[model samples]
Target: MQFDFSARQLITRLIFWLSVSSFVGYLIGHVWAAMTLVSVSLLIWHYLHLNKLVTWLWNSKSLSPPMAEGGWGRIYDGLYHLIRKHRNKQKALNERIRRFRDGAEALPDAALVLSNDLTILWGNKKAQNLIGIQWPGDVGQRIDNLIRFPEFAKYLEAGNFESPCNVPSPLDAEKQLELRMMAYGSDQVLFLARDISKVHRLEEMRRDFVANVSHELKTPLTVVRGYVEMIQLAENDFSPQWLKAFSTIEGQVSRMDRLVEQLLVLSKVEVNSDVENSDIVNMPEMLGQLIEDSQWLNVDKKHEITFDIAPDIAMLGSDTELKSACSNLLSNAIGYTPENGKIHVSWQYDGERAKFSVTDNGPGIKAVDVARLTERFYRVDKSRSRDTGGSGLGLAIVKHVVSHHHGELVIKSDWGKGSEFSIYFPNEVISSLKN
Candidate 1:
């Protein structure tokens, strides 16, 4: 394509110029008839060659370009080079696509390629078996129509791929699958599915074990506390040392009982993830009750407690779970804050979102420890947590409840200042429950 056409053009142009000059010379010498005949013949020959070159370029159907002679050969050579380069580029592109398809096919997870409209464009072998869509027969069929499920369809329509959705397997009865989708190109989607039945089953087993153990331990713990109290009542018969031992026994027993109760609540929350959302919680009523409980707990410390509740900000969620989560935050704040500190409980809607937050004038948590505060048995000051009778599972239970309600638990604090903890519910869940 880069070959210089100027040489060919220059020579042809020079010949034409020479003919015109010769014709003028002859005309001046009074040989006008001879010059006219020579000019006409040259003009006719040039037009014929030009027409032939145009026809070859526009209509020729050959593997190679037309075999041209003279100046036309250069033009033909440039066209041939361009055509070969284009063919090479096409071949390379096709090879890369083939390789990509091969790699995708080798993946263990099922994969689906969909068009802009969610039509089945292509699918791998795993998809054929798991998704139950035949390759050629199902091609161009709507994916939503083929694999219909309310949750899966809503996930597709939502256009938010930040999370994956779990759905029952279309193939096996005892199997479950996690489906994740990603968008590429111009509106095309790629969906992948992985079997998660084993993982799900293991989690269920663990929750069941914890719930059973917690439930069983409650009775013995109550009996132990009862006997310890009975011995304290007969303190006059024993020494002061015996009375002190009874007090320690009673406190440790109560602490252990609280831990067991928290564990049971956490297990129940985890197991009841699929519970129906039929409980409508009255916000002010719940908060007022929590405030009363906090007041009694703070009697010794005499901390300032305040409430900024939106009376009408009620929600449809598990009342038991919500109360537990909210109470844990309040109790944590009360326990951690020093005497004369302030604790504020607020519930309000900020334009598009609603939140219930607890602000405490306590020693702020460390930056590195804040992230893991929600983990079970995690404490910044283990001795202080023990003194406060905290089982260290309160935040863990709060985290589980928040996630179960499709909400987020946010923690914000600065060193030596106070900390604010909030539960921000998902807009979709709130809107749906309101309707």
Candidate 2:
């Protein structure tokens, strides 16, 4: 339709030029002069068409493409159709982007789109509320400048997103926020912030509740144990049956007392969120003490126990926690091994981390129960565990202790062969003693 105007104008101009040329020829009485004027006018029309094409090419952002007639018209029309297709595609893409942003805005957690340079590009409404971002007002501002959290900046630069970092929520001091980053789309990063304040508070409540109950039961347990021991000491005052009953009572009470003490220690370990004054642990000395305790524990079974300990192995953590973890593993080995069976304990450093392992030639645990071995009250052989006076919280206590020290507990076993329980303290928590 646009080219039709060019066509009509061309035809009108050609006719007008021919009539003028004819008039000039008539006035001059020369046919050659009129023919030359007509040719020049035709050449002028071609120049105007070429100029329009050049202008269209130069101003590529123009709303509409230029139009022409004759040979140039086909070229212009082809380019115009191509531009229309491109514009349609662009419109569809823009719509999809808009929909994606709307979906992101609806998310509950704060979400931010950041440039490779850590500049704030875009963010959702929740992000605005949480991070106090004013959208377009802070568009080009550096994200670190706004958040000012040292750990977050460190994590961003570290580029190790395997774990998230926790920090206080920007909106409320009481709230805790977990922040993680996902890298995408040409060096850009997607940051997500979740409020974990509720979870934090619940964990705190659980710790406090466990601690309070353990503390309350301790005094009564001590009195009961004292009376039970006194009764055992008194002889020839009752029938043999009554003495046997008293013995059972004494054993049961002692078991309960031990459980209570462990519960108290476990609660204390759980409640401590950070380490304090923990760098003075003597690993070799600690292992030696554990060997002595294992020997005493195996006196009834008379099992053969061995220790291969590495010297200069020290770690930074609560001494009580370390002792509990190592002692529990050794106790499990000594309890399960048959009389005269061999048990081996090793303390070694493998460059990256220090490992404390207890391996025994006892009845191997089933594969089904291996995963839950660390769970409180879980037992592969419940009857055997009870017969051996296991309170069923040893492994659970060990797990908490290891985790408190930022270490790992790994269990390996082959059916009918043996079980090996190992604690690996990461290098971050391990250092050599000065001596």
Candidate 3:
């Protein structure tokens, strides 16, 4: 322990020195010579201690202070305390890092840290087992080089993490992985790979069940609808109440037939990958035909429909699916919009992306309903939907088609005002007539 070097103590030391010099001078018969001798001896003692402190500070690793007396001793002790405090803080920090790494290693999902350049910085053991990222050996390797799937590479380069990509594991043919990338800490990426094989199998089973049942129901539904129509044609053979009942049956059977057909289409689109079959779609011509069909469907409502189609605005996708999606949009607008309501459609490419948008002055959807419009069998107003003859699968089919073509369905609506639905296709899929 070191005590404070107070001014009073310093004054006492000076007085002692003066008295001793005066006594020595009286004996030596030279006062100046005695004082100079005392001063030089004190300077030499301080210099030796200062040298020791400097040497210890510059070269020694020990946290203990150097042995000294007076002011130098206090300084050494202060430095030792500072060094010890810093060491404790550093040790605690190191321990926390160890705990975090241990916890990450115990995770079920494969986790990896990647630099902005997508180089592997660190990975958990699960990453090694699942994606074959070797410990220490694969560090500093480009992640794209390791997971060489073209889709994965594209997804990484796109810088979009709102959705994850599902791909098969490289090591096992049957295993499925859902990979997601997240941005964290100073331009680093947290890449996660989850084993979604069970989930994928279940989804496949659901799709297969829907597809098989829809196929089986299609024939029976057709037969029922035909018999109902035949009974409706012979209206005089039945009483007025029976005829009304038969008409209701006919309408319901028709709606059921539409629902079954949509289910089949939806299942088909879901089963096929985004790029399963590729072709250049003549979007302008397709929209023109759909507009004509919408006009026929709009005869009763008399909605004022118009379109501005860019001449050569084509895209690379499945033509049948695209047409179906476009038809759904137009049909919905005609069915829902009030009489004489304005519906405008446009197709344009702004170099970066191609867009198809439909704007309508319909009974606009509420904010809460807009988000779930694409879900199968979702209805904002069930009574209104039923009156309009909607099967509640149109928007769902549209969403799947857009997603299958690597596009997005963007819906914007203002309650009691109007709504706009747009599909945006990235430039990679944007094509043109090769004239």
TM-score of each: 0.81, 0.80, 0.84
User: Which number leads on lDDT?
Assistant: 3
| C-alpha lDDT values of all predictions | 0.84, 0.83, 0.87
- Give the alpha carbon lDDT tens digit for every residue of 125-167 in model 3: 9998888887678999998898989789889778788899887
Residue 25 local lDDT, model 3: 93
**Candidates 1 and 3 compared by TM-score, better number:** 3
Instruction: Identify the runs in model 1 with alpha carbons over 4 angstroms from their true place.
Output: 6-68, 115-117, 133-137, 426-435
Report the Cα lDDT for candidate 2. 0.83
Off by over 4 Å in 2: 1-43, 50-67, 115-119, 139-145, 148-160, 365-371, 375-383
Per-prediction backbone clash count = 0, 0, 0
Between 1 and 2, whose lDDT is larger?
1
lDDT tens digits by residue: candidate 2, 216-258 = 9889878987887788788678788988998888888877778
In TM-score terms, which candidate is top?
3
Model 1: lDDT of residue 94: 99
Q: Any runs in candidate 3 off by more than 4 Å, and if so which?
A: 1-66, 134-137, 233-236, 276-278, 350-352
